[model samples]
Target chain A: MNTYTNRQWIYSKRPENVVDERHYSLQTTSLSTTELKENQVVLKSKYFSLDPYMRIQQSALETWERPHPLDTVQGGAVVGQIQDIHPSCREFEVGDWVLSYTGWQEYAIADVSGLRKLNRDEVPLTTALGILGMPARVAYFGLQDVGQPKPGETVVVSGASGAVGQIVTQIAKIKGCHVIGIAGSDEKTKYLKETLQLDGVINYKKFTTQKEIHLELKRLAPQGVDIYYDNVGGYITDAVIDSINTYARIIICGQISQYSDGLDTPNLGPRFLHKMLYKRAKIQGVLARDYNNRMPELLEEMTPWVQQGLLHYKETIVNGFENLPKALNMLFYGKNTGKLIVEV
Target chain B: MNTYTNRQWIYSKRPENVVDERHYSLQTTSLSTTELKENQVVLKSKYFSLDPYMRIQQSALETWERPHPLDTVQGGAVVGQIQDIHPSCREFEVGDWVLSYTGWQEYAIADVSGLRKLNRDEVPLTTALGILGMPARVAYFGLQDVGQPKPGETVVVSGASGAVGQIVTQIAKIKGCHVIGIAGSDEKTKYLKETLQLDGVINYKKFTTQKEIHLELKRLAPQGVDIYYDNVGGYITDAVIDSINTYARIIICGQISQYSDGLDTPNLGPRFLHKMLYKRAKIQGVLARDYNNRMPELLEEMTPWVQQGLLHYKETIVNGFENLPKALNMLFYGKNTGKLIVEV
Candidate 1:
């Protein structure tokens, strides 16, 4: 077999505050003999997911359990085709498209347990990294399990144009909730209203102060929000939380606003207890990984919706393996409209 | 029958800040000879309940539902003897003791539906205002329904010496959880540990700073707290929330800490989203009245425990109807060891 080179992004240093390419090192390694261990299979990645969560792993932040150390391949979910497999491995065949947490590399030696084969004929393979995959599952579980939006209830979603937020908005809408999407730019808010047909869109950029945000939220959710799918937790979340009705559900899916600073930044919002006590609200946090075992149930409900054009998704794909850092930074700046991915 | 005079503390003015006697006025009204309204009963209050919730009604603050207007009789829960009833009323007897939301008055004319008859032989009549009544019901529902403490889990009770908090602590222990009580005084803490048999007690007054409280919490709850029954919300809550374990349940029962100032004071605690996201914790607010229909189930379980000496309660009773304001102020200052009540 002809030798192929594996291009990889390695974590070199921790980002002080905002992450950039300076935090990672790109290196190339050539395959030798194409040998694999007993349970390992060599897979060639088609799409590398550039998620906001990747920044947490790269920074050695305490945001997640089992923090990744420096000088290791940047770990992330990737859609890949199996090029070779060990004779002992029974899970895959050559050219089989599979989803795996194979990191930022072209080819990875993965175990059978680390990969799940996907059918490209049924749905586009790249969706395993976006709409039909982990992000979708996050939105589904978070919106349903935590947010629990009832019919006719107003559901507010922050970071409404991002991968998870978009799905969260659509799912809440599908659940018969009056969904309000809060985004940074007019472009995002406009797209959410015009394309997704959301109930309302509040461009947070137009509202500079907390009072402004509060007023905008009051206008959008007149009776106060019943469900809040919080993606960007800070002023936006505080504003949404301020307008929550009694028995409101605030689901914490991501705190991208604080993730940049490793959440060390001080929050000057009112203490949660008083408001919670008065409203009898429930604020719950959800991580997609925690609900991995329940994916089949999520996909069972979501797949038909996607197949029937009831659910929509967008991808901001940066070509080439080297653009991983840039693609991820797009998430931090709110530049991406939907799923931010790197196509290798 | 001889005419009787009804003396009442009317809500003369809205308290600007900390509630005092200035907000209330003593007024007397002679019983009219008018025929009794259907289903109405004349109640002579034996024990007037001066509760923290009463302060909320006394203030024009935006906490709790259905604000009270000035010059109305100050509304509160009370244990009273039936003085007279309408000829149409068949549910109650003239000498029967009942629990009623009769406000701060020696006598109140109430509808039959507004009162629940009490059994003084099984438990003390005054307990209908306290441990065997509203406070106990709050603790039972808040702890079991919201907190849901698991066996061997660390359960922290804030305002641990207060009526609801004391009951919550004991119930958590009965559920086989390690109970930690956070109180304002060393005397309260000692009572929690010695009398209530709590696993640990933190006198919050001894810890002036959040850091001090956090360190002490870390040492006591080495594995982190699994459930938090938060009655007093502020620095103590912030510290406890900081050390919450993954999937921890935080039940917000009351915010007595902020009630004194009508929750106007800004809290400098860390924002909850990031930590809650990482831990996947659930923080819920509970109002006992929301679970009012479930009180029969709570009392069924509690009556046996109280009768068996497995459950204990304390009350700081201020004598005479005149000490209502002072008795309530004692709740604000954390002067009461357990339930704070007034004998009329």
Candidate 2:
């Protein structure tokens, strides 16, 4: 009987503000690979996906799912290679790269049915955790389906340097839209303007108030914002909403700005629903999970674009199993320019 | 030359709070009927529509249109009789009842193309101002088109006793929805529950806080709210939003609560866009003017429902043109049961 040592990051405490080491505890367990059940495979996690939604799940209130049950393996997606497999698992071979929702663990036992075989020859294995993963799914559908961007239309993306926003900005550009990206730092804004070739960029950190941000948006988008893709939803959302043109579409993909301490006890902002009435606009919330069944549809188009170098992406990798919790905490501080991932 | 003494309520000053006589100046002018232009008819205003949107336009900020220009007769809908007609005006005849956008004046010249002929015998003449008029246009489309209420689904309406809201609640009931209404006073709640036969009614004034109101909604709607028709935007909206179910549709028809003083400087409310992402909900704004071209389609269905008494309505008529501004102001106080009209 062969055995492997598995290290797991257990979510111990619920977070009221930012998630840190105090919220998670590392645990070591021994797993016997010889006793694998039918259709099960032992996975050695290579990369862990860190998302803002993890903080939202740690909230005391009920969100998309019931507060990702406490004292469990910190639930998340992982990109890994199959170390061992049950004899009944004929679909996959040993040493095959795959994507699985096995969370932050050095080794995880997963069902063969739950694993997506990753072809490293096609794209980098890390791309499975980002450009072709959940972030890309939301950015593709949220912007294309919900936003329905038209050529010559103005699209404003908040958190424009983040995982989802970067893809959203690129897709908007591909759609021939006059795209504007709003980020927290000058480096992010610079990348969005120079690399992403965005029509406009606003470093929201420079603005003291929502009014100042709104003034900057007004100066950049003189014709008015046609579609607002909001990820950071605090004062930045308030400012972008004020600049929406008549019949505008607002896609609420994420509220990273409010997820920290505001999910349970929401922060107060000025009511701007009157603007929706005046503009005859529509605001729709989009989640990547909602399009989980449509991943093939997404890959059919996105896969080709990614291969052709038309779809640009960046991953800020934090190496080491111990830094899993720390990497998630860094997301809230706007330290990562793109997707934040922990590599084991 | 035949002349009529036209008393016009010129919007003299913009109100920071409630609109009143102080904001308007009543001027007497002699309009000559002999000077009617081609395709123009002389209209003697009988019923002046006092709506919440008037207050929105009075705001210093630009709404759907520019702020209602100062020192001009306040723009509004009027149900009146054609006293005289130009020789080339073939559509309208003298003494015919019609609806026109004639503002606050007791008499005005209207182009034949701008008037919608109202048959007083088919329904009450004032029905042109309430059930079968602009209010009904928004109510029908806002509820049916935007809300898309399904059978057995829970529908909650804020400002449930107002002109548009009354129609919305009834239409929801007709669509086989379990309708709940939220209103200011017990009298209004009684009307909603007993008169309209809603599945539930919440007297929002009884609850001092949003949490209390949210708890009341939870008690009333155990399955959760699927559709929310919001005519009032404030704490009532915040509470109802908290009680929404997955895939809920929120119709922002009017924000009467914010129009008085909150329009220019919006009041603060807890951010709830995070809930939208969790529930995959939609919030859309609908205006009657946007459906103006589709009035015939609305009338085809609504006109009969109203005539057959299947669709019920009420009107709080305030007599005399002298009370025009006061009647408009009374809406903010929740004094009117249904459509508020100033009879000249």
Candidate 3:
């Protein structure tokens, strides 16, 4: 075996205010010369994905303020190549490209269960994390199964330029829903409408209030929205709920507003459930990882849409593992336009 | 020509506040012998069942508050005997017993489209409204389908002494779940435990806080409540949500607290969505009228249970059509246990 070194980022300490250079410290460790276990493979990570969910894990100790924790190497997805595989690890060959939950690392030991052989080489490897992997899968099933958008019905997606929201908008469009998107910037609003073909885009920064929401939504979708894919569950959700058509469905895929800033803080937006009951609406909470059998079903459905040029995905990739925090910070601040990933 | 008289309560005007005798006025209306139209029948009401949903219909001007129209006599279930039938109405023969939405009246002109001919006479006529009709059917479907209780689960039913709650508590018990009921009084609590066989009971008026809730639930269930059948959607719902186990389901069949109360009044307690999301729970809002096809199925399933001494119903009957407003008031005030009805 060739001599090698594996540099990894381990969980240093739980984050308090914000994740910076200190919250996660870079530690370089030597590769073990010990015999490889069966069904294990040594892989070289080519790219790593940074996401807001990690910030949730970083602040796990914040008492319902943050999400749960992972005790091992900070978990994330990586596009990697199989360097070597033990005899028991079948179906993978040396040099085969694979995606694994290897986190922010240069090279890592991957368990077979966490690895998937990448297909469709022309599509950028980074798309695996955004439009093809977890976030995209979330948007795919969340809108279809949970939101249950009907053709020609009005559909609204918050965080439109983010990995999940972008795909959700495009998917709704393909299904013949009148799609409206909400983002925080002019460029994202333009991208959502011009590039992704959304019917309307609302910059939440430019306007707020139930009245403004009513007027804008009426102009864009006069019939009223039937399905709301809620990525940022705060006042925006409240506004959207206020404008919902009867028996509307809401997919609570994430509460980016609360999850990013932390939950226990006084900055969190007020709760919204009365609106849910008033409209006789449904709100479903979900994660991409929870879509086990659904993941491949969605991937199969989306592959054709992407191939037919109906679906598009954009990635904002940062170079080097040291920028992992920066790439993830983009997610928290809503700075990154699509899926945020890091190349090592 | 035969003459008929109906001593009925009419909705005098749109309800400006919680409905009382002021919103209604008792008047005697004489009916001239008018010929029954096609698909119509003439019926004399034996019992008019008063329900919590009457409150929802009384406040229709509130935008979301869907109130029944003024002077429509306000619709609800009535057990009646068909006095005459038109040539086209073959489903019900003259002198056959039937259940219909005949409103607050001694006599009703029923559209055959909206009436159910009673098949099983083994049970009392009042059960047609209280347990075997809309309320009981709502309880059965809401708990079985929406609440989705499993064996060994714990179910918490708010308004546990009311028409729907009594049936839900018993059904949960039949499904092998430990049931905790929230009623307003000790006598009703006794009815819940001794008659309805609920595992535990709480007078939500007395105990407060998650601490008291946790203590009672811990002692009774220890395993945590797995399903919440919420009828009174206010403080009691808050307590039930606090005691729910992960992945628990809440059936939002009625918000008795919100009906006819002014929009801005203090009807809300704790917002339920956060706990719903964190617990991966499901909350379903239901109306029994939407489940008409299932009525025959429900009657078939529940009749045996009622006849074999497994299922039972409680009726709080107010004598005479003059007492319709008072019976309705009793529902709003929580003064009547189980279904409140007026014998017309």
Candidate 4:
């Protein structure tokens, strides 16, 4: 029997704010070939997907039984190659590439349920972390299903140049809905209209006045918006809620604005409750994990779009595992455009 | 044709607050014995379901709609006999009893889509306005589905002695849940535990401190409340929002605390949002109309429980159509238990 060792990112202590270098301490541990469990696969990290959801898992969802003495690596996205596999794990062969939620580490051991066999030939394995896996599926399901975007209806997506928001805006356009993209910068805003082909784009940072923000949104959504994909909460959420048309639907995929502060109690303004009644709207928080059943269909739907150059992706790649914290910080500050990737 | 003209409760102007006689002016007119439109039914009023919903309707859902003239009637509950029916209206007969959304009126005309023909012996006709109709179905469905109560799970229903709250508490008990009812008065609180058979009851008016409120709820719900049905908003809502268990579900049926002032925006202190994420709880606002397809099934589930004397109801009846305004005011003020009915 061969012995194998792996570096695992474990949640050490709960984070109290934006996850900084101080919140995580990376350590390399060894495993003997004899210690490998049945159905375990040793994965060599390839593509790492940085997401806002990782913030919650490190701070709020660290309920594991492992007794840790504070700082350690926190968990989330990694696309990797299977270096070794226990025979009991029949899902993959030793050389197969896979996307696993292995966090910020060079290598990790995963049970069969956590790894999905990757077909990089259809779409590159790296795309699996961004436009093809969680963000794409979140875009596919959140807009098409939860937001219930209808043709000719107006749809607005905030954080438009980011991984999830970029796909959401494009999908809305494909469905014949008038898409409006709201981002923080002029360059990303320009790219949204010219590159992504969204019907309208707004650089939200310019509108310091509520009246201007309201008027700009109203101009973009003349008939009023039928769907709002709220990735950014606080004022963006407030503006979107106020602008919704009758029977509008909002899919709350993430609250990037609030996440930085570590999900504090949000001041939900009054008009929101009133709108929920008058517009007969629905707002639901959804995690992509819940849509695991639809992954095959999602890859199928998004395949042609990516291949034909209909769907484009941009990656801000941090070359070493050591810079994983910096990559994560980029996402928290809204500095990265498209997907933030760590290549080890 | 013998003419005994019909009258309607119409919204003359936009109401800025809880509707008073000043906000309304009843108009009477005679209808010609002319041919009816397809899918139409002419009805004579028996009981109108005066609800907090009418307050929104009276404002024409405005803060959200076009600057159109006030609607023909200030909406309320109504049960009436079919006075006439369009030849294409397949569901009704001249003598059939039907419950409808016909406003404060002695008589009204409705389309088949808005009318539900009633079976007299199955439950009292008034049940359409109270226990066996919209309010009852809301309590039943919201609790059974969203609340997902289990035996020993603590469920709190605020505005506990109102029309919907009374039914929610009873249904929770039927499903083997420990029920806690919150009302405004001691008399209503006594009725909640003794007559309504709730496991525990609290009068929020008596609990002066938010800490006391939390402590009392913590005592009754030692395991932490699994569900909260919020009918009344304001401090009571804030207190219950704090006491919920992880993964709790809140069915937002009404916020009577905001109905009277129209301008009363309950400031949910900023931390409530964090509670939602940390608790992984769900808060959903449900309109009974959206649950229309389940009405027959709702009656079937509730009737047997109601017939076995397992369900009890109380009504604060005010006689005459003139007192309709007063009856509805009681509903907003949280001054009545069970359903408030008007003997027109």
Candidate 5:
């Protein structure tokens, strides 16, 4: 029997504010190929996807699903290679690349049904964590289905340099929309403007108040925002809402700004829902999991865009499994430009 | 030439807080019917519709339209009788009851195209201002079209005794939804529970904090709020949002609580949009004007309901045209139930 050592990060504490290393405990275990059941395979996790939702799941209240079960593996998506497969598993072969929700671990035993084979030569393995994966699914559907972008309409996207927002910004441009990208750093704004070629970009850190941000957005989006793809909800959302045109569509993809302490005890902000009434606008919240069944449709369109270099993406890859919890914390600090991934 | 004395409440000033007599100047003018043009008719305003939207229009910022122009007659809907008609007008004769956007004036000359003939014998003429008018229009579409309520779904309506709320509550019940009403007073709660037969009622005044309201709502709606008809936006809305079930639809028809000062300078409230993300919910704003063309559809269904006594409504009619400004103020104070109308 062949044996392997698996290092796993166990979620040990619920966060009241920011999630950090203190919330997780690293544990080591041994896995043997002899224990593999029929139709099961052993996976060596190559990459782990770290997302803002990880923090949201750490929240005490129920979100999309029950708060990540305490004292278990920190559940997340992983891009891995099949290390061993049981004789009953005919679909997958050893050494084949695949995607699985094997979480923050060096090795995991997954049921073959739960794994999706990845074409190693089609795209980079890391893209499964971002551009060709969950983020792209939400961006395609959230903007196209809920936002219903039209030619010449203005679209403002917060967290523009992040995974979903970056895709949303590019897609809006592809749909003939005048896109304005909002990010936290000058570097991210530069990428949005020079590389993505967005119509406008705003670095929210330059503005201290929502009123200031509103004024800047007014100057940039003189035609008024027709669709706002919000990923960071806070003063930035308030300002964008203030700048929306009549019949605007606001797609709530993520509220990373509020996932910290605010999710447990909400942060107070100006009441602006009255603006919805005045503008006859609509705000819809979207989750990538809601569109999981439509992945084939998303990949069919996105795979070509990505291969053709029409869809641009950046990945801030952090090395080492021990750095997983620390890398997740980088998202809240706006330290990463795009998808934040950790390689084991 | 027939002469008449017109008492007009001219909107001379914009209010910073509650709109009252200080914002208007009462003027009396003599008008001759000889000046009436082709396709024009003279109307004697009888019942002035005092709605919460009036305060929204009075805001310093633009709402559905530009701020109500200063130094002009206060714009509003009125149920009136045609006193005279030009030879070119064949649609109606003198003494025919009609609904017109004639403002807060006792007499006015209107183009025939802007008037809809109302049947006095079919229902009380006042019904044209409340149950069968703008309030009912928004209530019908805002609840049925935007809300898309399903049977057995739980609906929570804020401002349950107000113009739009009363109609929304009854329609939600008619649609087989379990309705919970949040109102300002025991009288309104009693009306919602006893008269309207709502499943639950919450006197928001009884609870000082949003958490308390959320707890009470949880106790009342153990199944969770599937639809929230928001006529009042503030802590009440914050609480309802907190207790929403997945895929809940929130309809924003009116924000009476925020109209006074919040419209100009938005009031501070807890930012609960993250809940929207967790629940995958949606919030949509509906304006009566957007569904003006569908009035016939609304009247076709609601007229019989009002006449057959299946759909119940109330009107706090303040006598005399001189009280128009005061009646508009009553809405902000929550002093009137259902529709507040000035009966001249």
Candidate 6:
């Protein structure tokens, strides 16, 4: 039997604001190669998905469901290589690449039931944690079923350069809708406009006041926003909502801006209630996990777009297992341009 | 030709905060028996529905569309007597009772195209302005379609003693839901519990802190609220949202709490966005006018409930056209238990 040293991040305490090292303790542990249980696989982490949703998990809000026990490893989507598999695990081989919602650790003994085998050669294996995985699925399912972007309609996406937002913007464009991307940085706006060919772009960081954001939104969506894909909820969502057309659809997948602030986060605004009524808008929150049953359908629709050069993906990789805390914080500071990941 | 003096409430100016006399001018106008124009009928107001929606008309907010001209008669739903009809109008005759958005006036030269003929004997003529009219239809359509209350689902209604709220409570009860009603006054909660037979009642005015309201809601909706019929959007809504269950449906028919305060109204609080996401809830704003196409269908379904004495309708009538402003203001102060109307 072979023994190996494994580095793991354990939840220490709930975060008060933005997460830091104080919220977690990285400890070196040892694991010995042992006989695998039936239908179980040994997973060696290749890449850890750094997402704003990770910040939600560290928060103390009761609404933030703890999928794992406290003081256990902090959990995230991990693209891993199967090290050893039980004889009963027929779906996966020892060398097969896969994705699992395994916690932040160098190695994990995971049930095959939660593992999805990945075809690494077709695209980057890290995409199993990103574009071809959670983010793309969220973009496809939320926009198709929730936003329902239609031809000639105006669609505004906040966090427009983030993993899910970028995909949502492209999908809206592919559907023939006029896409307006709202990103925090000029570089992000440029990427969305120059690379993605979004119909319009708003650099939200350039706006100082709510009125400024509202004016910019009105300028970009002259016919009014028919669909809003909300990745960041705060003043950006407030401004987009202000310009919504009749029977508009608002797909609320994330509120990254408020994740750190928790329940004390201010609402979109006071007029949000009235604006909703007058516009007769529909606002719904979507969880990609809930739509995993339709992942094959999502892959069918989105894979062609990527292969044909219609969809482009971006990655912001932070190297090493030790950089996990800093990588997670990058999401809060808007330092990451697209999908943020930590390579182990 | 006979001439008569008629009093009319005209929109004088936009309200600064809550609507007041400065926003309206009671004018003594004159109407004469003259040959009617094509599609024009002379209407004598019998009962005027002075609703919270009228306050929206007086507000300076641009989103609240003024369907009628300002400095003219203040528009509202009115139950009227057809004193004379244009010869070209074959659908209505003199002495017919009908419902029309004829504004706050004793007489209006209305277009026959906008009138809905009413059977005065089938129900109280004023019921055409209350239960059997817009309020009831709003309750029927919004609850049935938007809320989608399932049997045994926990349903909560804010402003539960108001026109539409009371009806929504009854319909939710009939649908076999565990009904919880929240109102501004204790009397309102008592009526909802004793007369309406609601499963639970929360007197919102009794709670000084949001925590108190939240605790009470937790006690009442032990399993969490599945359906929320939002008639008032303020702290009460914040409390209801706090207790919402997964896949909750929020039917946003009215936000009477903020109609007076306009855009300055405080939000349902910061936690609302996260709660919606965690619960995968649906929040939709509904206008009864949008459901007019389904009016006959709604009436068909609800009429039987009313006839069988399964649904009880209540009205707060303020006699005379001079009291129009007073009657409309009652809705803002939570003075009216049910539908607020002015008998002209």
TM-score of chain B of 6: 0.95
Which residue pairs show backbone clashes in model 3? B60-B67
Compute the lDDT of residue A132 as modeled in candidate 2.
Answer: 95
lDDT of 1 by residue, A71-134 (tens): 8898899999888877888767888999999898888888888888899888888788889888
Q: Tally clashes: model 3.
A: 1
Error of 4 at A288 (Å): 2.0
Candidate 6: residue B268 Cα off by (Å):
8.6
| Model 5 regions lying over 4 Å from their true place | none
Q: Candidate 3 — which residues are off by over 4 angstroms? A: A1-7, A12-22, A33-35, A55-72, A83-90, A260-280, B35-41, B60-66, B82-96, B119-121, B242-247, B260-278
lDDT for A336 in candidate 2 is 96
TM-score of 5: 0.99
TM-scores for chain B, in order? 0.96, 0.98, 0.93, 0.91, 0.99, 0.95
Candidate 1 chain B lDDT trough over 10 residues, lowest sum: B261-270
Question: Any runs in candidate 6 off by more than 4 Å, and if so which?
Answer: A264-271, B264-271
lDDT for residue B290 in candidate 6, whole number 0-100: 89
In model 2, which residue pairs have backbone atoms overlapping below 3 Å? none
Q: Assess candidate 2 and give its TM-score to the true structure.
A: 0.99
For candidate 4, lDDT tens digit of each residue in A202-311? Answer: 89999885457668999888788888887777777677776887678777777777766635334444434655655656665556766779999988878888998898
Model 4: which docking level applies? acceptable
Q: List per-prediction Cα lDDT, in the order shown.
A: 0.84, 0.92, 0.76, 0.76, 0.93, 0.83
Compared with the true structure, what per-residue lDDT tens digits does model 2 show for residues B239-313?
999988888999999888898878889899999999998889999999999999999998899889988888878
Please give me the DockQ of candidate 4 compared with the native complex. Answer: 0.24
Residue range B41-136, candidate 4, lDDT tens digits? 778888777777766555444543443257566666588898887788776789899888777888777888988888888778898888998888
Error of 2 at B8 (Å): 0.8
